[model samples]
Target: MEKFDNVVLNSRAKYGQFYTDPNVGRLLVSRIETAAPNSVIDLGAGLGSLSMAASKKWKSASIVSVELDNLSYFSSLKGNHFHIYADALDYDLPNKIKNEYGEFDVALCNPPYTRPLWKPEYEKILEEAGLSETRGVPKDGRAELLFLAQNLRLTKNGGELGVIVPSGIITGERSLDIRKKLLDNYCVGSVVDLPRGVFSNTEAKAHILFLKKSSPYKKNIKLYEVKKEGGV
Candidate 1:
C-alpha cells in the first residue's frame, strides 16, 4: 500500500508531493513562535507534519488541522492529531475555533503550488462563480491565496498568522496582484524566503509569511530569499 494509506488517507491521484519535512516544519513553527494557539488551524494538513510539530511546541494551543484528500484524514498518522477532512474553501471560520483545542489564537497553512489540475476544476466553475471566483476564495482555490484570506477571517483582530506560500506571491507580476489583495486586508509582518532545497523534489519555490490580521507592523518587514535552507 502507499504511504498515506498506511498512515493517513489516500485518493490514489496525487495533488502534489511536497510535504514540509520535520526540519522545515520546525523552522516554520519556530519563526511563527507557535507560542500558544488560542486556536490554530492548518490547511493542506498532510500526515499531521506541521500540526504534530505545533502540538509539541505549543502545548496550550488548540489546533484544528484540515485536509481535503481522502488519504490524509484516514491516515494512520491520524492519532494524537485533530484532523478535519473538509474542502478548505467551504469550511467555516470562527473567531474562536474549537477542536481538541478549546479555542484558537492563530491559523496557518503550507498551501498547494498551482498545477495543471487547477484548470479543469476551475474553468467550468468560473462561468458561474462570482466575487469569490474572481478574487480567489481562500478555502476554494490554490491553497495560497485562499488560505491567507481564510486565516484573516479565522484570526482574531491583532492575532497572528504564519503561512507558507509561493515566493511569487511577493515577486511575480501576477502574484503581486495577490500580494496587493493580501496587503489590503492584513499586515505582512515578516517574510522568510524558504530555501529551494526545502522543496527540491518539487518544481515550485516557497515563502514563509508572518502576518498580523489587523494592520502592518511598525518595523520594516523582514525578507529572505531562502534558496535551500528549509531542510526536508
Candidate 2:
C-alpha cells in the first residue's frame, strides 16, 4: 500500500483497509457462480483481493470495485475490474450502477469494523463512510449498519451480498436494528465464522454473512456454517 493510501480516514486506513486473506477471498469469489455470471460490486475494496478473485472465477463477471486509498486504487487497476476512487458513503452509487453493463448482481464488502474516533456516534461514522446523511451525528449507529444499508442499495433484485463484519456486531445490542434490517431486506444465506487471528494487524473475529435479496422471485433461506482454524 502506498504511503498516501495508508493515510488514515477517521483514524483507520483510508478505504477501510483490511486486505482479505487469500483463501477467504478465493472462497468468497468461488461462491459467486460463473455459469450465469452476475455483476459484482466490491466496497472498501482494499487491494482488490476479492475483485481479482471474482474475475478469475467468472471471466465475464463485470466487477465494480470501490477504493479510496491511492495504493488500493492502483491495485484495482491490475485486474479487469472497474475501479471507483471515492468514498462508499458519498459516491453516487446508483449512477455507477446505471453506467455498468448490467445491474449489480452481487455486493461484497469488508467495511471498517470500528467507528471513527473523532465522533464515536454511529451517524458520524456513516456520514464519512458515505452511506448516509449527517443528520446531526446521533450517538447511536455502528458502521456495520451503515455498510449493510449501502450494500442493500447497490445489490439488485435476486442478487447476493457477502459482507465481513465483526462477530460481536451480529449479537450486540447496538446492532439489533441492523440485524433486523438485514433480515427484512435480504435472506441470510450463511455465517462463516472467522477467528481472531484471521486479521493481519487486528484481532477481530469477523463473521462472513451471505445475503440474497428476495422479492417474489427467490424463496426460502440457505445457511452454511463454515468453520476453519487459523489462516488457510
Candidate 3:
C-alpha cells in the first residue's frame, strides 16, 4: 500500500486542494462576531483546520465538516468534528441533521478554485435560495462562486458566514455579477485582504469575507487590510 502522505498528496492533486494554514483558519474564525453558536458547518473542509479552530472558539457548538477528498476526510476523522465525505455542493444533508444539530448558525469555508461549466443544478441551487437570475454572475462561473452560492443556501436566515476567497472576486470585473448577488443577499460584515504568500504554496492573494444572511438587504460594508501584525 502507498504511504499515508503519498495518498494525501495524490488526493490533493486530484481535488485541486489547497489546505488552509492553521493560523489563517484561526484568523478567519476570529472574525466571527458571535463566538458561541449552537451549530456550525464547514464546507470544503480540508484537514479540519478551520473546523478545529471553530470548535475551540465555540466551545459548545456542533461542527459538521464536509470534504470531497478521501485522504483529507480520513485525516479529519480523528478530530472533534462530524465528518462527511462527499461533495459539499451535492451532499444530501439530511433534515435530521438540521433538526438535531440546529439550523446552521454559522458557516466557514475555503472553497476550491475551479472553472466548472455552468449546469442546470446551478440554477436549482439559486432558485432554492430564493434568488432570481441576476446580472454579474456569468454562465461559466467559477466553482468557488458556486460553492459560495450553495453555502448561502445552507445557511439559515440571520446566520453568519466566514469564507476565504480569491481577491479577484472583489476587484475583478468578471466577478461583478456574483459580488452584486452577494451584497444583495447578505449583509456584508467585513472584508479582510490578506498579504501575499500567506498560503505558502500559492501566490494568489486572498480575502476573508465575513457576511450575515439578511432579509430586505442592508447597506454599508466594512473593509479592512491585514498586515504582518494581523490587525485590520
Q: Each candidate's lDDT (Cα)? A: 0.59, 0.62, 0.73
Q: Pick out the ten consecutive residues of candidate 2 with the lowest summed lDDT.
A: 1-10
Q: Model 3 Cα displacement at 136 (Å)?
A: 5.5
Model 3 / residue 165 / CA error / Å = 1.3
Error of 3 at 209 (Å): 1.0
Question: Which model is ahead, 1 or 3, in terms of TM-score?
Answer: 3
Q: Estimate each model's TM-score.
A: 0.72, 0.75, 0.84
Q: State the weakest 10-residue window (summed lDDT) of model 1.
A: 1-10
Question: Which candidate has the highest TM-score of all?
Answer: 3
Q: After superposition, how far is residue 40 of candidate 2 from its true place, in Å?
A: 0.7
Q: Please give the lDDT score for candidate 2.
A: 0.62
lDDT value, residue 3 of candidate 1: 26
Write the candidate numbers in order of decreasing lDDT: 3, 2, 1
Compared with the true structure, the alpha-carbon lDDT of candidate 3 equals: 0.73
Better of 2 and 3 by lDDT: 3
Error of 2 at 223 (Å): 5.3
TM-score (C-alpha) between model 3 and the true structure: 0.84
On the 0 to 100 scale, the lDDT of residue 85 in model 2 is 80
